[model samples]
Target chain A: MTAKITVEPSQKRQQAKQLREQQLLILAQQILQQDGFAGLTMDRLTALSSVSKGTIYNHFCSKEDLFTALSVDSLQRQLQLFQRALQIPGHSREQVLALHLAYHRFSMTEPTLFLCLLTATTPAVVEKSSPARLALRQQLELQLAAICQQLITAAIAEGSLQLAAGQSVDALAFVQWAQAFGANALLKPTQQLGLFSQLQPQPTMLLGVNLLLDGLNWKPLSSDWDYHASWQRIMTILATEAPGADGQLN
Target chain B: MTAKITVEPSQKRQQAKQLREQQLLILAQQILQQDGFAGLTMDRLTALSSVSKGTIYNHFCSKEDLFTALSVDSLQRQLQLFQRALQIPGHSREQVLALHLAYHRFSMTEPTLFLCLLTATTPAVVEKSSPARLALRQQLELQLAAICQQLITAAIAEGSLQLAAGQSVDALAFVQWAQAFGANALLKPTQQLGLFSQLQPQPTMLLGVNLLLDGLNWKPLSSDWDYHASWQRIMTILATEAPGADGQLN
Candidate 1:
C-alpha cells in the first residue's frame, strides 16, 4: 500500500491532510451505512479509514463534528437535487411529483445512507444533536416551501388558481412535508401501505400544492384576514374544555 | 428464591401447567420493557419466572412463539379498541380524528409492546414471516374502512363533496396512516435531537395533520361534508404512513 517512498515535508502535509479528511468521511459513512450511527467510534474510524488517531484529530474537533459533516453533506445533496429539479419546467404538481420520485429513488439507491440519515436506529448517532435533525427538517421544509410557492405562483400566473381563506402557500408546504415524512416513516418493502400506493407521492406531495390549486376552485378559497378567527377556534379547542376530552398533548 | 416447597407430584404438575401460559407472557413483557425484546430468552424466562426449563418448553415452542403471543395480544387490543370506537356516533371526520388520537395514545402508553409488534429493524422480518404484518395491517384497515365509509356517508349526506378521481376510504385511511408515520419517524426526544430544540414533534405532527385535512377537504364551507372531509384528509396524511416503508408497499 505504500507506493510513495519520499516527499517534501510541505507536500506530505498537504497530502496527509486531504487523505485524513477523506478517511474520516469514508469511515463516517461506513459507520452510518454498515454499523448504524450508534456503532461509529474513533476506534472503528481508525480501523476503517486506515489512518492514525492523531490524523483524525487534525481534521475534526470531535465525533460530533465528524457527524455534522456527514449530515451537512446529505442535506446539501437533497437541497441541490431539489433545486435542480425546480429549474425544470412543468406543472407545479408535476414538479412536486418529480421531486418525490427523486426522493424515492434516492432513498432506495442509497439505502444505508438514506436510512442512516432518516432513521433513528442508525448507530454512531446522537439523537439529541440539533445540528443533525433540525437542519435536516428545516432544509427539507425550505425545498418544499419553494415548491409550494412555485406552484402557487405558476397557477396564479395562468389564472387557474383558487384558494379558500386558510390556504396560504407556507401552510401548504408544511402539509406536503408532513405527508412526505409520513410516507417515509411507514414504508416497508412487502406490505403495500394500502391506499397511498396509488396517488404516487411524486404528484400528490403537492398535497400543499394541490391544496392551493384545488382550493382555488372553492368559493371561499382566498388569502383573507381571518387568521384570528381560525386561531381563536383552534385555541378554544386547545385551551378550553371539550367535554370528556383526555389525551396527552405534545 | 425458592420457598418452602412441599407439593405432591400431581399438584406440582397441575400448577406448572396452569401457571405456564400466564407466567411466560408476564416474563416476556417484563423482559421487553426492562431490557428490550433482546433480553427475552427461554433461559432468561426459566430463571426469571422461576419455572423449570422443561415447563417453559411445554408452554412456548420457542422465543418466537412467545413473541408471537405478545404480538397477538397487542393486535387484539388494537382490534377491539377500533371495533369499540366504531360503535360510537360521530361524523366521519370526528371518528378519524379519534382514531389518530387513539393511535398516538397507544404508542405513547405501550411503547414496548408497540415495538415488538410493529418496529421491525431486521430486513427479513416481513418477508420471512408476514402473517403478523398482514393480520395487523388488515385489522387496522377494518377500522379505517369504517371511517372512510362514514366520511363518504357524511359528505354525500351534506351534498358538498367533490373528489378528484380516485378516492376510497381505504385509500384515505392509508394516506392518513402513512402521513402520521412520516411525521412521527422524524421525531426525536425533544431536548436532544440536535441544535434545534423548538422544532419539536407536537407542532411537526400538527403540521402534517393540518395539511392532510386541508388536502382532503373536498367540500364547500356551507356543508358538514367540508369538516368531515377536512378531518379525514388530516387522518390520511398523518396516520397512513407509520408502518415504515422499507419493506412495505404504500
Candidate 2:
C-alpha cells in the first residue's frame, strides 16, 4: 500500500495542478457572480471548486491572489475586444463609433468582472496591492495610448484633421479612455430607464476626441482655435523641454 | 440611580435625542475617513462617538442609517459646489465647456466622495435610504438636462442649429449629462497629475456637445431614430419602467 501510494504521486501532482487551476477559475467566477466581492471566502472557494483544502493553498496563497489572477485574465480578454473597436482613421466614423460601443459591450458582458477590477481599482484597494495594481492601471493606459496614437496619427496624416504641437495624442487617449470608464460606471444607470439605449457615447467620444484634435490641429488660425492655445503651448513646452522640473533637462 | 434618572427623563428626551444624533453623525464620518466602509461597525460608531451604545441605537437604528445620513450631507454639499460650476454658460459652447470644467473640478476636489456616491450607488444600500440617494442622482440629471436644454434652446432660438423633426432638446441633455459623469469620474486622476493639462476638457466638451448638436441637427433624410440607442439604454429603460435600478444615477 505504501509502495502503491508512492507510485501515485509525481504525474498526478502535475495533472491535479492543472485541473485545480481551471476549477479555481470557475469557482472564482461563480463566487463573483453569485456572492459579489464581499462574500468571497477560502472555504467557499474550495467547496465550490470541489478541490481539496491543501491543494488550494499549494496553488494560491490567498483569496486576493486567486481573484487577481482571475481579474488579469478578464482584463486581457477585454483589451483584446477593445482593440477591435479602435479603428485606424481611414475607417468610417461608424468604426470610430464602434470603439465606444465596444466599451459598453464589455461592461455589460462582464459586469461581475468589471465590478471586480474597477471596484478594486479604488485607491483604498490599490494602495495595498501596490505594484500589481499600479501595473494593471498602466497596462490599460498603454493599450488606450496605442489605440489613441493610431487614430490621431492616422487622422493627421489623412488630412481629415490635424493635431497641434506637443500633444502626445497619447494624453488625449487617456482622457477619452477615462471618459469611457466614467460612461460605464456612471452613465447607463443614471439614465431614465433605457435612455442609454436611445443614446450612445458617440457624441461624448466625439466631443472629447474632437476637442483634443481641435487643439492639436495646426489646421489654421482661421478655424478660430477658440480654446486659447496657451494651455497647448504649456504642454508642448513641457513635452519637448525634457526638463527634470528641477531645472535640468534629462 | 433609577429614581434620579426618572426625575429628568421625559422632559430632556428631545434634547438628548439631538445630542445623540450629532454624536452618531460624527462617529460615522470618523469611521468613513479612517476605516472606510468595511471597518465601520456599530460598536465602533458607539465607541468613537463617545455616546453610549443605547444612545446611538436610539438615534440611528443601525450603522447603515448613520452612513445614510452622513452620505446625504456629503453628497448634498458636493452637488451644491458642482452646480455652481454650471451657472450662466457664456456661449452656446460655453454652456458645454462650463459643465465639463465644473464636473472635473468637483471630481478632482472630492474624488473619494464622488466614488462613494456615484460608483457605490447600489440597491442594497439604496432600498433603505431611498430619498437621499435617489434625490442626488435625479438632481444631477436635472442639472445636466438643464445645461443641454440651455445650449440647444439657445442655438434653436438663434437659428444657429436645428432639431430633427421629432427630436427634443432634452435628447442632447441626456447624452451630455451621461458623458459628463463619465469624463469627470475617469479623467480627473490623470488630469490631476497634470499629464492631461493641455487636453483641457473645454475642447472635448465643445466637440462632443457639438457633435450631438450636429447629429440631431434635423437633417430631414436622417432615419436613425426608433432603434435601441446602445449600452445603458436597457438599464435606463428598466430604470424608467421600474424606477428602482440603483440608488443614484451618477
- Runs in model 2 with CA error above 4 Å? A1-23, A35-42, A52-71, A85-94, A128-130, A165-168, A191-250, B1-42, B52-71, B86-89, B122-155, B158-161, B164-168, B188-250
Candidate 2 lDDT for residue B241? 39
Candidate 1 share of real interface contacts: 0.22
Model 1, B136-211: lDDT tens digits are: 5555545555655566566657754455444554445556666654444334322233323445444444444444
Candidate 2, A198-234: lDDT as tens digits: 5544344334333333334324321343222332333
- Model 1 TM: 0.55
TM-scores for chain B, listed for all candidates: 0.61, 0.56
Q: lDDT values of the candidates? A: 0.51, 0.52
Question: lDDT tens digits, residues B90-110, model 2?
Answer: 444444444455554546555
**For candidate 2, what is the TM-score?**
0.63
What DockQ does candidate 1 score? Answer: 0.13
Chain A alone, TM-score per model: 0.57, 0.62
In terms of DockQ, which candidate is strongest? 2
